[model samples]
Target: MNPEIYSLFDEPHADNEYTYRHNIGVGIIATYLGMKLGLSKENLSALTLAAMLHDVGKTRISDNIVEKPGKLNEAEYEDMKRHAIYGYELLKNIPGIPPSIALTALQHHEREDGQGYPQGKSGKDINLHAKIVAIADVFHAMSSSSGYAVL
Candidate 1:
């Protein structure tokens, strides 16, 4: 993780609008995707914000595991999966951010088949922002050469 990303998790007072700093491609793709989906400008902003900060909970994870070069052990994987909930916990109380934004962080890992972590909310239970973020996150990860790419 970048030192700045670490500060994002460690420093609560730091800026939360980290899309421009962390994943500009994801932001652009998410916005474009949202526009394609016919989302309004206000909805687009919410979608962009949710996509950018979706992984902010990674700060709660251990650096040793986060920076590990090899694939993680089962325990490490499980621990890392808690980032979704950590992100929700981190953002839920912030005064300015929307509740949907926090839900986006919480449910981005959730799947339609109830296979996702933290919660198994399937189908309609999942929020739209989370579903959009999931798609954008996957698109960015696969297209980029970063270590996060799994497919």
Candidate 2:
């Protein structure tokens, strides 16, 4: 891995271990799924990177919101959702970060049914990498033992 990329995964975060592990797990699973779906090598690499950093915006969230143990109230839930936009802003201008990678952060929360957040973009409007990450993110959260309040 390039040092620049390594530094991204290595960046210190005040969040708990579960969030880190979830990112790793989602990266692996999303890459595997993408490969099975016949994504090219370049796309697979992008998918892995994007999926791993899908929740990178969470680092910018308040500890109280990010680490909240139980269900969040309406206001907090709305606040928690901003992590997607925050993640996009954080990665969009990085020298080596591709547009797709930055976009994955912004669109991963969007859904096929057009009921997603931030932009509420539907189906084709959301990037493919983001869609894959969304699936992987949810899968990792649901499969893990940790109590993820939301994805």
Q: What 10-residue stretch in candidate 1 is worst by lDDT?
A: 12-21
Alpha-carbon lDDT, every model: 0.72, 0.83
**37-59, model 2: which lDDT tens digit per residue?**
99999889989999888888887
Best by TM-score: 2
Model 1, stretches more than 4 Å misplaced? Answer: 1-22
- What clash pairs does model 1 have? none
| Candidate 1 accuracy as lDDT | 0.72
Evaluated with lDDT, which candidate comes out highest?
2
User: Model 2, 19: alpha-carbon shift in Å?
Assistant: 0.9
The 10-residue segment of model 2 with minimum total lDDT is 6-15
Put down candidate 1 lDDT per residue, 75-135, tens digits, no spaces: 9988888888998998787766567778988998888898886788999999988888788
Model 2: how far residue 69 lies from native, Å: 0.6
